[model samples]
Target: MMSSFMRKSLGQFLATLMVIAALAVTSMPARADALDDARAAGLVGERADGYVALVDSNAPANVKNLVKDINDKRRVAYQKIAAEKGVPVEQIGAITAEKIIREILQPGMYYMDATGAWKTK
Candidate 1:
């Protein structure tokens, strides 16, 4: 179990990481036919689990593949962080999702809230 000091340190660490992640997402250069494009075009949406999902069930193969690839990477990252911090991977992911939704999501972008419904940012 984490001590009080360790929990405080972890909280600070997560806050800093969230800011960095938000800045990274916001500062990225947009590329054609990429994640940004997919998001802007309403082809995809962010989930409360810190992963991207297709807004439409009939989205193209490319969108599916992109979501799969990105989510896979995120899962790996979350797992690493969770193991290091002795926390559940889902907790890390949910925290990350909160940051992304509040700081990184742009107007017209879609995200799933706690009710499992997609809403525009």
Candidate 2:
């Protein structure tokens, strides 16, 4: 039903939009309280592999969903950075996780070690 030129143009436009969306999502700051509150409540913690994990198995549904949302966003950002740096996503996550554990984690915050044990920093 559409001409070749129109289809090509639409394809390019969609691709551009996807790139813009990805950039926007990656650049935007995380929403407040969603993660911080969960962490403070001992519902979620950072994993040594650079992902969010449930510290309390009995955490609320909202807290679990929050962890999934944050980790999904992080995966997208990591993929973008990995592509730009020509490195594996796992490497980026590992390095990022180390930095997070060493620098970003605050006192009294929880994080999981490589052995899957929860530790408070």
Against the reference, the lDDT scores of all candidates come to 0.77, 0.72
Residue lDDT tens for model 1, 3-119: 999987777577549534643554335432487888898999899988889998888998888888777767777777677667777877887788778887889999998999999
Tell me how many residue pairs clash in candidate 2. Answer: 0
* Candidate 2, superposed: residue stretches over 4 Å from native: 1-30
Model 2, residue 37: C-alpha shift (Å) = 1.2
Clashes of each: 0, 0
| Candidate with maximal TM-score | 1
Task: For candidate 2, list the clashing residue pairs, or say none.
Answer: none
Q: Which pairs, if any, clash in model 1? A: none
Error of 1 at 72 (Å): 0.4
**What would the TM-scores of all predictions be?**
0.79, 0.73
